[model samples]
Target: MTSDAQVLAAIINALGAPKKIPSHPPKYRRAAVAIIIRIRPDHGRSSAHSSKRRHRQQPQPQAQPRQQTSLSKQPPHAEQPSCLDEIVHPESLDEFFAQTWVQSGVFEILFIERANKRAGDHRWTGHVALPGGKQASPDEDDQETAARETAEEIGLDLADPALFRCVGQLDDRELWTSFGRDFLMVLAPFVYLQLTPKSPPLKPQPDQVASVHWQPLSLFLDRLAHPQWTPMVINLSNKLAPRISRTILRPLFGTMALHSIEMPYKPEFILRYQQELVKDTDMHEKAHPCSFSHSHPPYPPAKTRTVAMIDHYPDWDPGHRPLRLWGLTLQMVADLLELKDGPIQPDIRHKVWDSHRMRKRLDAGHLPGFSQADMHFWVRALLKFHSWQQTEKNKPSESNRVGSWESYYRMVKQAFVFVVLGRATAIAVLVRMLRAPMFRMIQSSVPSVRHSKLLK
Candidate 1:
């Protein structure tokens, strides 16, 4: 054992060693932001292939874009604010991406932040952004402030900004200013998780989010509510059964005094909101007897029901896109066959892939004309080809989605896995073909797992 003096010297040296300064410094002021919609698994997760993410694949989540279908009827107070109260006016605020990382079908997107230093225009700034910073609470009426705060933070969903409803509100505390004027600031937070408009992902506010997602409530809520169920945090009650413990906490009551008080929504909010939409207080919404069809709306058809919904997003045209087909494709095909003997497809060809018709055939309990064993063989062959391509000298490796289904599906939900990984990867312009199938897969599961089937 070292002597006390020696130990003390070591400790001093450790402390004295030039502290590992942050690669970037805080060059800007702290602004008010509400981390709404924690995860957008729908668009998948992506990490820049260049440089990003601190904890390798940190949740690359974003608020989903609004639907364009019903924007003309947007409410007057729903529009986000435009005045440049804090930072300079935003030039562009779309969700953009660099390269994608697909690990076992999980895509990770990296965000952009002001690179700790204020004087540079480095695009590779930092991640977690707070683009929305403003007085969310107005005088007696709070719609303008709410709309503005959301606009500032999440401008991606706002070409027709008035569509965003001022549904929920959270009030922050007051902070004293240097001039002795008490700054009555209430962190105004709003959500667009279920916004209608979607496409080309609005725009990229390199300062807001690197990428935006169209996360479903079921998937999104699953993540926020089931955060590994930490022991220190509140234990979920058994009443909500599985989710009885974690439904969407809303109104959080905490001290109002602060530098910019951050608030939490009680879980009941998510559950209750879901109920209100279904129960429909009158002009609230239409009424339905709560059928599985409502819960999972996009079911192929009654005659075309299948044991599983295979997303064929990236597989637009198998013959033409086969060049980019990765090994995981083969593995999933094999699993379905193994589960249902003979082969999931006795009518469809192993090489030909089209999800729409495939969905129909699978539902009818009949393969279109594809050989199950042959499909497995093709899958194995594809996996080997991908392996060779990855190991080849100069070719860019497929450093994404694990090459096998064993990892892609994980344990939770296999069919649902690729939907996310595929979409996220698609955003980064990697494995382009997978995007459509992934989306189709998500649509398939929507009715089955969704808490609400209001999808357009």
Candidate 2:
């Protein structure tokens, strides 16, 4: 079995070479997140290669001369205040690495809670997200964008290649608009292996980050964490289904959230709102189907409906604490855990992945809360539902439909058994033929019964 460090190194190297820096860069607004890995000393022997070999494969950081000074001068906020630690001054990269290495198998990952959004902004505000934002003009590539964002959000410098190791990148993902009508911003997640023994004591930018969390990688792997699930309602349900994309972020982020089928439009909901509007009397004419007034402008009164539309998401609280981790952040953690295994493990992978694969129709706006396994079974159920609906539309008798489904299921079971029996028989014959000479001779003699019978 490969060590954790070896597996991570393999993943990074396997990410392949990134594309060249485009002149115009296609004008697509992009974002990038850094998945920083802090390698703890394994009790077993380490298989790390020389620094020279590793450095040769890594892309050199393009440092801006004035960035260090400019970042230091920014005014600090009163809330969630942070202080930058003394910079580590080392004689050489070797010295820096030597001082930073520690003897622990546990690794740490970082996440940030975003500050509350300003009013009227529909984007993800006051959400827990990875430390990243829209790519800036100065960013030469996605790597640079990730590095720059990390430095700005948390005072860690990626430009100094000696201080950090760029372990390649995960796939890119898209953050869509509130209505899911179009792509809000495209995100590219880059993985980094922190050379320092301890995680960087970050000075978070208060305006952007509400708080910083250095969560143990081991804690995530713990089955006890019991990642939570919450229902999310959005306009475009199908667009959010996790698709396997090479250029996009789907592969990298590795989908985790479970989505439900689009529900049929609720005419009753409209009626309820109309009744409430008429009760207020202010917009009573507007509420009536036939009543229309120029002054009213055919809009319901603001004080109309009293009920909330949707339920809160991230409902499954692992620790039942105030802090909750879900959605994209949780998905990224799941993907990182499977780095050594190669490709996301379906059985253990998120429900979003399986749901997206089985998804046929995209109609509903709300993703009802369901477990990873529930989503898997739901997908299979959906396949059956579609078949049933088609048959039902033809107005088949209840008894006939039941009989047909039962027969179909029985046939499937018999086919499976037949295939298993054939494969087993073939394996048994092959095994005897490949055995020792004595066994082979015995087999030939035993087969003499069949041989003679065939000859006769």
Model 2, span 1-456: residue lDDT tens: 223334444455455443222223334678788887665544322223223334677798787677665645766652222222112554543443333132224466666667544547636554556777778889888888888998998778877765677766655554543223355566677777676544555665655655565565545443223422344432222343333432363332222344321111111111111224334555565467555646554655456543322221223334433445555665555445544444422221111112222121121112333233433344345546545654566632222111222232233334334444666798899888778887767887898798899999
Compute the lDDT for candidate 2: 0.48
Highest-TM-score candidate: 2
Worst 10 residues of 2 by lDDT: 264-273
lDDT of 2 at 38: 65
lDDT score at residue 84, model 2, on the 0-100 scale: 21
Residue 296 lDDT, candidate 1, scale 0-100: 39
The per-model lDDT (C-alpha) reads: 0.28, 0.48
- Measured over all alpha carbons after superposition, the RMSD of each candidate to the real structure, in angstroms, is 33.1, 23.3
Give a tens-digit lDDT track for model 1, residues 313-399: 222233331111112122221122222212122221112223222222211122112122332333334445545544563433221
